[model samples]
Target: MKKIINEMKVRLPSHSENEAVARTVVSAFSALIDPTVEELSDLRCAVSEAVTNCIVHAYRDLPEGEFGYIYISLRLYDNREITVEISDNGCGIEDIKRAREPFFTTSESDERCGMGFLVMESFTDRVSVKSKVGKGTSVLLRKIFSPHTSEEE
Candidate 1:
């Protein structure tokens, strides 16, 4: 069977729209993969973290009309692995290493847990981030799914 790639784009004001967007994106993938409840939750959490980062960190200084954009792409490989890419054209990370550190956050004023990257890494098979100080940021995540089965081989 041929692999399938699905993509979506969303423009949200900020945290207010985060949950809705995440749900919609994940639901789309669930339709094709039929992921278990736990798998679906993991996917939603990863996407939520990525989107939240874009909303809170990216475009931090821009005013209301400036806007924020999220581009999500999902690719399913033979019903085994799913690749998700979330890209934002906003103020990129100056130091990805620092950003990924557990409990280390630049948003001290906002009381953020700073566990976004860590959670994403823990749930996905592979996680990669590419960014330029002033250009933008793109987070690529991949996860492999195995069907639930019980048998003695």
Candidate 2:
């Protein structure tokens, strides 16, 4: 029985410092469902990747010292389901399909591994993306924890 428990929305600057803020907020929110340690870790890592992408890539074209915003929304369900939507208002991807491919970064620097979506997909139950070239991008990640059945076992 999936029912809405609560929902939270946060809007912060596209600064690196706020990445941890987003991750911590999701961790605390999901903790209400008593997720396993591994589940919490996976959720945090996935959120970190999504948020980091916004800070690093989303506003790369902004003029010096200019920064945009990163918006994150979290919804918790009675069935132990949590959906996180991370979005950015900045230059969007030109090729959504190719951008999702591993090691397909637009960055010229050697530091980028281009594994953001891969990490998100690997960690979450479902990963979705929406974007336009000049508008912005949104990545939605959903994770559902199984009902407790240890007593039956």
Clashes of each: 0, 0
Model 1, 14-119: lDDT tens digits are 5546657766766676567677667777877887888888888986767866676777777777756787788888899988999999998888669799999999
The residue pairs in collision within model 1 are none
Model 1: weakest 10-residue lDDT segment is 7-16
Model 2, 11-93: lDDT tens per residue? 98998899899989998888777787788899999999999988888888898888999999999988789999999988888
* Model 1 accuracy (lDDT, Cα): 0.78
TM-score of every prediction relative to native: 0.85, 0.93
**lDDT score of residue 13 within candidate 1:** 52
Predicted structure 1: clash tally: 0
Stretches of model 2 off by over 4 angstroms after superposition: 149-153
- Give each model's whole-structure lDDT: 0.78, 0.89
